[model samples]
Target: MISVRVNGQRFQVRAASIVIHDGHVLLHRAADDDYWSLPGGRVEIGEAASATVVREMKEELGEAVTCGPLVHVVENFFDIKGEPNHEIGFYFQVALSEGSPLVDKARSYSGLESDLRLMFQWHALLDLGSIDLRPAFLRNTLSTIPLVFSHVVHPGADDV
Candidate 1:
């Protein structure tokens, strides 16, 4: 994991997948979290950000994905466990390979990675604002993913 603690603040580089189907987007969250986020994980040292998205999908969901173009580059500042945190996120369009059980959009799914339990769901893009999706800007931006790349900076809890 490309994560470090400096001056009591956590910094990490993350790569996430954005998978849309039938006007819905795939999202997931850890068992203990009240909000949902994209399906990917921390970028490992020496690994490309795009590769991290593919690897994380396989590791976390037991599903293979085809990584697509980079959609957004985000500088997100937030807090976790009373500690300040900063994250550099690479969001990429991705598609599940054929025969993926996770393709079902009618219901939610669950998986376990190591000791962490994860819940996966598909949420309608039109109703995104009604749910708790962190990096909060995503509620408005995801509905119209730009054709070209985009960069965003979310100040912190108060604004994002």
Candidate 2:
């Protein structure tokens, strides 16, 4: 579920993914081959969202990403493992260094399939509208994005 201005208090929600590089946004195609999404997952117990982003990115893409302030937060509601639920996803600004990702001991950390075999790639921000996303989530996200921000954000939820 995305964040809402409930009585003016900013309650954080989900663990939204974000990674910007050369005007392109990193997207994740789950190993199960479901719908594509920004590279991220639910916030682990006791972990901060920003930290989660850093850890998740490092695990999924095989690179270290520098993250910035909270650019936007979307309320996400979806079916996970057959359960309907919601979360407030914080989209922090981030940057990726220039290079190809390599999975090797000398290059990075340890792990096997969960950290390696996943498929991720970049797509032009301007082309985001072509992606299929959760409708309610995207509409609310775009409507609230601060106009001054220009980082390549997702289409919020849907409309892409």
Worst lDDT 10-window in candidate 2: 103-112
Per-residue lDDT over 1-160 for candidate 1, one digit per residue giving the tens place of the 0 to 100 score: 9999999999999999999887899999999999999888899999999999989888888888999999889999999889998999999999998877887889888867679999999999999999999889888888984535789898745675
RMSD to the true structure for each prediction, in A, is 2.0, 8.2
The per-residue C-alpha lDDT of model 1 at residue 105 equals 87
Tens-place lDDT digits, model 2, residues 1-160:
2334454344335554555555455665655655656666556667888887777777665668777777656654454565444456667766665564532213322222354455666655655676764423342343333423433323345622
Best by TM-score: 1
Output the lDDT of residue 130, model 1. Answer: 97
Model 2, TM vs. native: 0.62
The deviation in Å at residue 3 for candidate 2 is 17
| Candidate 1 residue pairs in clash (backbone atoms < 3 Å) | none
Scored by lDDT, the top model is 1
User: Candidate 1 versus the native: TM-score?
Assistant: 0.93
True lDDT of residue 18, candidate 2: 57
lDDT scores of the candidates, listed in order: 0.89, 0.55
